[model samples]
Target: MSNIKGKLIALGGGDDDVLLKLIRSEICDIHSHIEVIATATTEPVESGNAYKEAFEELGCSNVRFMHIDEANAADTTDHIERISKAGVIFFTGGDQVRLASFLNSTKLLEIMRRRFREEEIIISGTSAGAAIMSDCMIYDGYGHYSLIKGEMKTTHGCAFIKNVFIDTHFAERGRFGRLAHAVAHDPEYIGIGLSEETGIIISEGNQVEVFGPGVVTVIDASNTRFSNTREVEENEPIAVEHLIMHLLVKDYRYYLKERLFQPLTQTMPKEEAGNVALPEK
Candidate 1:
């Protein structure tokens, strides 16, 4: 439930009709303004146009396409104004680096974060967009070599959410080792691997509800008895013991503060929101 004022929605990747409908429900109404950001994509116009169409198909009359790149000014009065009026800010998938590097500390991001924290608006992203939600993110890591020490890369993210690392296309790309290695390297932060087409709605800072098809894997290493990340050579695989993990699907919820997962009871909240995989009809 988006009972809280602020909400963050992260999608692993892929778009589904049901997921789009769920996203629509986050806005105050169909008439609410939506800004589709394609800054992460190489073809921002085409990518932004597609999402603009998708939201319009959901009956959003005031959807606008926004593309910010190295060549443009992100904090212009016009961009700031549109972001202020937007009810939902949607980020399209592409390169996480381009997305974060461009907007990391912009006044535009400050406004968006403020609105998300103080208003009923939503801050949502997919794929690369999803990966940039955490304070630190996995910028690079191939699935096959992610386990090797120093293979995965991390850097400052949007910091919309803290003490966590997010990875998209988890299941499809077989990124378990990639994320596992990340958790071992930075055990202070929990690891969330979102499968393609899956997503999680995060609210009240710690509550996560699953809403799409696929799997949401949560990795916690706070209680690990041992780790060799410090001693492992650059090419050697790191290790961690006593690491905890949980898998969630639709109708399940995981609490970051509690580090626990529970099946939704029959009395689940009518309103659901947050990141990763869901089942297909």
Candidate 2:
């Protein structure tokens, strides 16, 4: 597979919705002109066009909307052709479970893999769309600070990015609980908690750059010192320690390659400052 050097962003819900400025910024950096394609995974036939209007506001003449639900209406080759040829693909936020069920093992998923592999194609998702980027996705809600049992479910993400668990509307929704739950269950992943209107661009070098108006929380437990809550039951507060979370703000960059953080302009802090010390795990 080719190196996926193209810019890829996972945005929280409330992105520059109608203007799509953030989305356009990523696309225009690589391509002179962008061909925007909108896919609605959650909407019914009646309301699917809602996202399409968002794309139209960017004033791209070549914007096309493809209903993945309509993939069954056409042959597999047609589906592949439509997706593979696009310059940028945008997945609208809604029910991520609905999105996964419709796209998994389908021609659309394959083409998405191919498009990323070939280079110059940007893939972006927001909210439920953002949640679906992880290999293990949170499909449904279970009250607060919870997930349905056996609901520690796994699904096919676009795999544009890997080993990273994503949750959107992070700060606003108090989603720290959701992301912490995911990391606690599986410590191997680095949880990406995106606040509303905020996004993080994961470059090919694995660098995660924060964008938009809010914060992108990075929960790094890969080298956690301790956790003794294995026997603990669900919804119960488990103890943990040394869980590192860095808030990446706009114009700041976190490079995954060097494992270093840098501010966009000088006079800003080069080293990340915040470290969450949880109860012993």
Candidate 3:
């Protein structure tokens, strides 16, 4: 039910170029007049520092680093204040399970919801950082082809994009199958498959744009061809149907509101098109 829109960059895995560019753009191009507050989860201050320094190098000021894991224990109001104030919030990926457990329902979570409303809050993370953005997240697994039952586990996400399930490092790990399984079971959801070093930018109006070097795959089930999801038993080879997949490269945009994919046009004239043609009896 959160209306505030933001940008999402789900990298396939490895590569810091796009992430750094996003940080610079969010801080310099967009929120040029706001303050920058940076923080990390816990135990891996090195990664957090790397992210903070990268942004700082781009001339972002007032950078504040919080030991979120240790400090977030007592209450969330403090965490909320720190997260909400910053112009951009960067989450250095470490352990998604730990991050979810700590932030779920906390004041921090509420602040994140508010930050998106008040200002242009850019949430970028790597590895585990990217996994927590979706309602159904792919955690603790390698890729989609390894159909080992229960190898990839699904956990609670920040619910930012409620309908879609996001998996990063997609092509690198061959994760299309894992996302397909999720879609097969419930064709109502959209699967966002981001490749390594790539990112997806969701504008204020929920328009999804693909950025970076690799590809961003969009699996839409609303008009899905078919899925043998229900036919197979649990943990079995999902009988997948003809899935409508859109593989987007750099600079392409997917507008969620229009329901029309940009730059790729498939033609079906009025006679054969479903909308303009009449049903023959």
Candidate 4:
């Protein structure tokens, strides 16, 4: 189980002004330090600069970039210190495989996990970066092929979030089938499909609040009646029953530990006569 007390913002590809503002708010002020890890991107320098510019435009002055271009960069003491000092860390989009290959078991990852669990830092990632936030991540597979049993390729992720699988560029890329197949394979895990420009901010390890312009799709196979995942061969169409789905928009909240979905209004407490009472869902 993940004991992370920090905030994690997982975003799909495209505009992230809202996310940047949120990160800034979590930190000190315009002078608060922010680190951007562009290891997943092929053009790390370019991507890093882009984020630096974006943050700077948002009135942030102390923004740094870290890239795993070489084998030893992730393990260097300098890199570790830089990550430790940051109030907020962000990851840019590209190929998740590359990011995992470079930082999976490195000292950088170790520090990141420790800081997240021990401090009040904020971690944000987009696209491929978002996909790697869970224990089990979808590394590869398209919508059409993903529906077939054993077609989607998955790998171990950073494991910042437990018992959940994340996929980005969901609605825009038509990845419902991909997430559905993933949920069918492991009914115990919740599959989150994030559309472009949308994201989920996970707090206190379990509470997830949806944000942005697009939708956030939650696929819960916990009560699935049946699936032929093990019996079917590769390329064979999969069959599943009773998979629950929640199409959430901005302000919707989902509790991972309870597998419950509720609007933000319902989850918030009502203050009346010096007494606080939470609304029952």
Candidate 5:
């Protein structure tokens, strides 16, 4: 991650005016060349056109989209050429398992990673796209059963960043257990659970600035003193001690290198986060 020269974003979906404007001003201007990758969605054309229109609505006329199925996953003739021309690359939501597997070890993926590391290109994704940005990704897991020893499943991801795993639709889907399990096992990586209508923009390959209306849960297992994950059976519940969790809101920041959280200075303040009023029954 230290070598990365790009901006990486993990979005949890929905069209927010703030997010759109952020892309326009902070990410890329309307004149910047953008490429939308629809490899995750089964309906590539539909997803691709939708993003194209969204960008166009933001006055980004140069936005183009393409689908990389198994057929063309390795094509270097046109696909590779297009990537070289891109200033910002976006991935749409769909099946994360399919996206990672389809683009695995391909020349297309190779160049994309290379450009991301060497250039100031912005590489971003939503939902499944967001989930595949790490080297290890959870392909299958239910929130309800994730605490069990062997309930979660992971595979090699695109490796845009190392020692980190991402999960999308956090609040709506109740995916805390799965993320907990992942970090508990790995212990070194941080598990980021991004809720819908929310996302994080990773800058300098170490810090992430949270955006949108929802919460971003950061699961850190680095301080663990005890864990029975090594002794638990398949259906048995696994218990781990000292699994640290951080809740972040809009404008908050988290540093991957130091494993620290930054509350927007004096704007909202970190102490106020715990003072949220509960909903009346």
Candidate 6:
């Protein structure tokens, strides 16, 4: 398991063509299989079909849907076997809480984690699916209300990355305050706000690079000097000091290990020179 490495793509909701193509090229070939899990979505059948069509259109011939609508379904031997053989496992958007509730601590999730650690597979998701990739997930919270104490709710996630707190449809939904609240609660964690149609690719070493047609906002509160989270009453606005933020467009790279941002021009590898094109501006 220590020698095996994989990739994780957390996407904000909407338009995943480029990201999917990249995943296919990196992890799949003509013979590789891709599993689309739509347990997080209310209409799993429809969502599954949609992804199946999309993947097929991308020339992925071995794409199948794994329907796990309940906790009991997650433990089925068939589901576990499908996951074990998949080159890619993709989760669809619905409700983060729903996904976590059934999948958490389940045998299926354990198998997925094991595959992620010991095999060369890609684990990707959008919207609520993206939120479940973190150790602490934002289950409930809205725009401005999230600025107040006790307005946000969080729960344990799939634990793909513990130090990152992910929020999808960030700017479009005005979710900065919610993500900020989570960062204020635990400054040691890095808060990632992904806008619609955007995503971040996190390598095994925690090297992250932004992609897509929108921006990715990063909020770092590790060096904060003050916060009134503890003193503020419920529903009261929080006051924090010295929180750092960075906006990243396509090609910008970030390292979670060192908490640093590297511009695309400086970090782009020579081998990938022409291959890395800037997202349409």
Taking the tens digit of each residue's C-alpha lDDT, what string does model 3 give over 175-254?
A: 87777766655665667888878877776535677778778888766654555555555566555546678888765666
Cα lDDT tens digits, model 1, 1-281, are 23347788888887655556777987748888889889999899898998899989888889998768878878989999999999888888899988999998899999987787778788888999889887899988887688788888888888777878888988888888878878877776789989887889998767788878788999987777788877889998777788788998988888775565778774434343333222111
Write the residue-wise lDDT of candidate 2 on 48-88 in tens digits: 45555555566545565565565443226765677767777
Model 6 per-residue lDDT tens digits across residues 1-281: 12337778888987878667877787647668889988888888899989989988888899999887853378888888888898888889999988888889888888888777777678899998889997888877788998989988888999876778999989988899989988888876889999988998888736788878889999988777888877888988999998889998887887675677788677634454234221111
Taking the tens digit of each residue's C-alpha lDDT, what string does model 5 give over 112-215? Answer: 88888899988888889899998999877797798898888889999888878889988888889999998888887889999888999987677788888889
Cα RMSD of all models vs. native, in order, equals: 6.2, 5.0, 5.3, 5.3, 6.7, 6.6
Clashing pairs in 6: none
Give the 10-residue window scoring lowest on summed lDDT in candidate 2: 272-281
Better of 2 and 4 by lDDT: 4
Winner by lDDT:
4
User: Runs in model 4 with CA error above 4 Å?
Assistant: 1-3, 268-281
Q: Over the stretch 182-247, how does candidate 4's per-residue lDDT look in tens digits?
A: 878887788999988889999977889888888899998877778887788877998998889999
The residue ranges of model 6 lying beyond 4 angstroms of the native Cα positions read 1-4, 265-281
Q: Against the true structure, whose TM-score is highest?
A: 4
C-alpha lDDT values of all predictions: 0.82, 0.64, 0.63, 0.83, 0.82, 0.82
Instruction: Rate residue 47 of model 2 by lDDT.
Output: 39
TM-score, candidate 6, is 0.90
Kindly indicate the candidate among 2 and 5 with the higher lDDT.
5
Of the two candidates 2 and 3, the one with more favorable TM-score, higher being better, is 3
